[model samples]
Target: MLPEAEKLQFLKKTELFSELPETELKSICQIANEVAYPADTTLFEEGDEGDSLYLMVDGEVSIIKAGTEVLFFNEKGYCLGEIALIDNKPRSATVKTVKSTQFLRITRHDFYNAMAREPRIGSGMFRVLNDKIRRDLEIQMSAIRKEVAQEESMRLAAEVQQSLLPNQEISHPYVSSAGYCQPANSVGGDYYDYLSLPDNSIAIFLGDVMGHGYHSAMVAAMTKSCLQTQIPFDASVPEVMKAITRVIEGSRTFIYMTCCYLIIHPDNRFEFANAGHPQMLLYRGNNSEPLELESTFMPVGFARFCESEQYYSTEVEWHSGDLLVLYSDGITEACNPDAEMYGLERFKALISEKRHLSPMKIKTEILSDLRVYQQDESTTDDITLVVAKFL
Candidate 1:
């Protein structure tokens, strides 16, 4: 058994029990078991029926989904496989120890028993689970953005993809935008565009459709046509998103596009919606940490996230010198020679360090860093990034 004070302290850190009243926490500490294991120990694997969840007191864990290691957590206070205990579902990913690790563990039986004693525990857990479901869905969607081998027949597809690129420069007095796409294949599935609206506001979007070849390119082209058509009719974030959704769903193909589309006005108001894309970062001047706009819904063509086929946008103010960063999964999920991902956290830290640079200069630094980080490994997917800076 671990020290009572240490157990209580780490248990308080787990999101599962973090918000519970102290009395309840102490009650949980009674049922919690302290455990330790060496590196490479299997906590659980994908497809296993989950019986327990763990809170890391201190240690490292790798999360593997479908044979690929997707994420790792060394951050103390992070919860592990939490929904498994709550829902009793088969594990969606495999989790294993990467270092000699310690955990505060609560099995399903103990969890239910504790909840039976205090109904409030279940209530708080379910509240956290609601957020967990959304977050897990986004993580799953991002993993699906992997690259596959393209056929030699995709030469014309390459030409079509090249046609999909919008002007790489955004020229406006109050705002500046720059985008870059470095395809790993002859035909890249990434696309981005911006249009100056009749009202003088600007609509900007970046999209990544998975897979390669002609069909993917055609679907992207169709999506572009839909976007242009919709803006003239209804440029509201929801309506334009719906139009894009219709084009993709109507295609009846096995592809989906993750997108972050935003409308920024001269008055400093910007509205955007993320459809299962990676989180967009908003850096206010020179703040060390960014305000993250996380994924708001399922990917565009996976239209089930829509309530009555309508979408919603998040609004935020863009102050002078604020930088908005949008990117494809390729950039953040790139693996190094060791098969370790460069990772989203590392990417964010890089941006936070370079938030003061002009958009194009920041773009240059991102490519520079990626090259240095990737070293001997050739990336399988396209590298795409967009940065908008308000002056």
Candidate 2:
């Protein structure tokens, strides 16, 4: 048996009963009997009817379920057998002492006695436990809501981004064009657009922003709108790029765009300009070799001082069985599970083997090769490609 003064000291230190008055605490302590058990003794077995609670005064106890220890409790104020005290439920887990232990035991009868005398204290304890249960439920519900919102946002952004791209197939009197874009994630920053010039010349453009997600998607949208407003059929590629650079420079957010633009005329002549974009490939069926049209200047938004005529143009004869491929860096830089890059060599092999295939087939084959090589690895970059076949 514990002395009256020591029992009161224990109750005063416990947060749950600290608010109780000294007289009520003394009455509660009178019903709590001190017990001792040898080491490795089972205090309560699983599935046993629970009718009492235990407060450890010394030594340690382990709560075990299915022969596996789940929780360990030590220290003077640790309480156990809460299922009995809270709801009169069967013991959900077994408890055993790690060493010789002393505990203050309180039975269901004693608990009812205290509650009967101080109903307000009983209500306060129940309220605190109820609030904790509600908080856990609320946290789980909030996590589910956040997940659903992110998925919906991605779906909507992807639809908007797709609407900004050119149609699947475009046919003009002089040339036929087709392109494909597959974002590694739900949204992307790569964009491609084609416009028929008033002078019967066809203008084509492909650009990629620096990053992915909503911020990059928004930048791509703004870039397309800005280009449409600034460039006309008469405007040279250099002039159009300069206008785009000016717009991006004025914004506080840092963003850069790599672009390749080309204008094709009726006489099979081509004028091309590049800004830090991947080299455009031109495959001539007559000769087994492929021509690489390389980049000439830094990407857009890099230059503060704009040059009046910093563009280059090249003329090429368009005949039957000619293929031109323009693509984003995502294709060549793709990595497999082994960390090997799908580099220029693989690209050249695919093209060399499928040179005779149609524009759509070539596009399909390239993407198929990328997926096979990646082998279930998630794509880390946005994939975009454009193919123009001269017929």
Candidate 3:
């Protein structure tokens, strides 16, 4: 128990009773009860009826909501529960003692008597409550504005990413081709295109940037720009890869890309190259297992290859009735509700079953099967697939 003079001094330091005269402070202290609480004690839970206002004589307390801290109060002058007392509402947050604490507690009945006799205490409490509410409102508005700005930025980025993709369809006399690209989010790193060359040869390309999102989409666009100008119908696979590698290596941001590029001539000759991308499957009419286009070079941006370094390209005869499929890892790595990956074996088996169908039908069935396997789970990466079949 503090002396009367000491109690009056502490109340003078508190905002709620600071304007009151020493005689009034002393009178109020007579009705206030001194309470001691041990460390880690919960003073009150959020949403409980708040009938008492506590003035801290010594100790610290924190306000928490849903396990997150909202505010903290300490020091002899700090007062809590005043807002609920003034508004006649429940407590807004949980208050717990941080250490062994001593407080001067004034219940609703005692507080009302003090407020009626000493109007200064009531006026001071109203001012304090208004200030607290204003500060909390400001914080909430700032957070809401930040969220809105981020959503708008993503929407614009998705629009720009869609525009970067080539919209032209491929029409070749010897083969029919179709391409598909579906980003998991508004924008992603997956990219694919069918380029009809000046020499009547058709070029097919698909690449995935290291990760998904804004940075990945930017890198994908840069990769497409580099490949479009540097690769020609007769350009060697190694040469095209070197050009793309230089662009990635020169970028200020750390990035890498995996790609598969193929060129097919009207003479039934085809050339294929892969840079750490997923294997391309060639389904022959007679064989159950599809031929794999094994990756022979490192992923772009991994290392700077010297001009003398050799890059390997596979040459194959595009026989009639043969179906070729190019895809990204998004297909095989798609997760199910149970977190099971749609593995390579399942993908191969689907192709074997759907090989006899047209290119478009094969693409559709594979996507449908993937959706069925995934069920309610969301895909984490961009899904892109392209198919070409020799007539």
Candidate 4:
């Protein structure tokens, strides 16, 4: 047994019992037994039922599992056996002495007696344990809240992107148009819009931004506003594209846009200008092969000169039952479970198969095929499709 003076010194070193009065410390020392064990002693094995708590006075103890030491407690005030004592369960891990060690063992009976004698001491112990538990719970709850906030932000961005899309049915007597956009994520960089001009011409735009996420979503919004300012229906496709290029090039921000603009006349003829967008697919009829109209210039905003020669124009006379499909790279780049791309061949086959279907039906079938092929893999790119058919 340690002398009262030595016991008081030891108690003072332990923060857990440091607040107790000298007399209380002496009382606790009377019931506690000092024990020494040699190196390599099995202090307690996993699955053993423990009835005593131990405080280290000297040397080290290793808490181990499956031959691996999980923790090492070498400090004078380090305590163990709390889990078994509080839960009344077997030890979950083994403890062994790394060298000759001195320790104080407090039996369950002695601990309860101390608690029963001073309810305030017991309350202090309970408060410490409860505070630690509450702190851990708060940390876990904070992580959950952060995750929820991110999802909410993404969902709101998606709704805003959807709001920017053009209405499905154009009210013009001579022209009929429909557009669809599917973002691989909650928000995407792909966008499409249609506007009716005062002179009875229709202005249509399809663009794909360089990246995805919040920045891309913001750029998409800015691009929509720029298009509104630059392209009135009276403007030819080339003029409208030039105006858009000017807006993007003038911005101080680092962003680029790949777009195609088309102006449709009431007489059933249309003119289009391309700016590094994917080829536009023209399916002449059910049995005919699709014609790909490739872009001639670099994507918009990359060059200051904005050479007009690089821009190209095309005119096509629409006939009843002819289908015009405009799409972003996302559709052709979509990968299946086997890592195969849904390339132009599959696109042609599907369009040929569904050519008799209405414009809406063709869009639905293509999207459905894309989903099934990907097997619900997360989308890596934005997808937009615009369909114009002569009825």
The C-alpha RMSD in Å for every predicted model, in order, reads 20.9, 13.1, 8.6, 12.4
> Cα RMSD for candidate 3?
8.6
Give residue 225's lDDT in candidate 2 (0 to 100): 86
The candidate, 1 or 2, that scores higher on lDDT is: 1
lDDT of 1 at 287: 84
Task: For model 4, name the residue pairs that clash.
Answer: none
Clashes of each: 0, 0, 0, 0
- Tell me the TM-score of model 3: 0.68
Q: Per-residue alpha-carbon lDDT of model 3 for 67-89, expressed as tens digits? A: 55555667676777877887888
How far out, in Å, is residue 188 in model 4? Answer: 0.7
Candidate 4 worst ten-residue window by lDDT: 131-140
Best candidate, lDDT-wise?
Answer: 3
lDDT of 1 by residue, 109-137 (tens): 98888878877676668767876677677
For each candidate in turn, the TM-score is 0.59, 0.66, 0.68, 0.62
List of clashing residue pairs for candidate 2 = none
lDDT of 3: 0.83
Q: Which candidate has the top score in TM-score?
A: 3
Checking candidate 3 for backbone clashes, the offending pairs are: none
- For candidate 2, the per-residue lDDT at 49 reads 89
Candidate closer to the true structure by TM-score (higher is better), 1 or 2 = 2
Better of 1 and 3 by lDDT: 3
Please report how far candidate 3 places residue 384 from its true position, in Å: 0.9
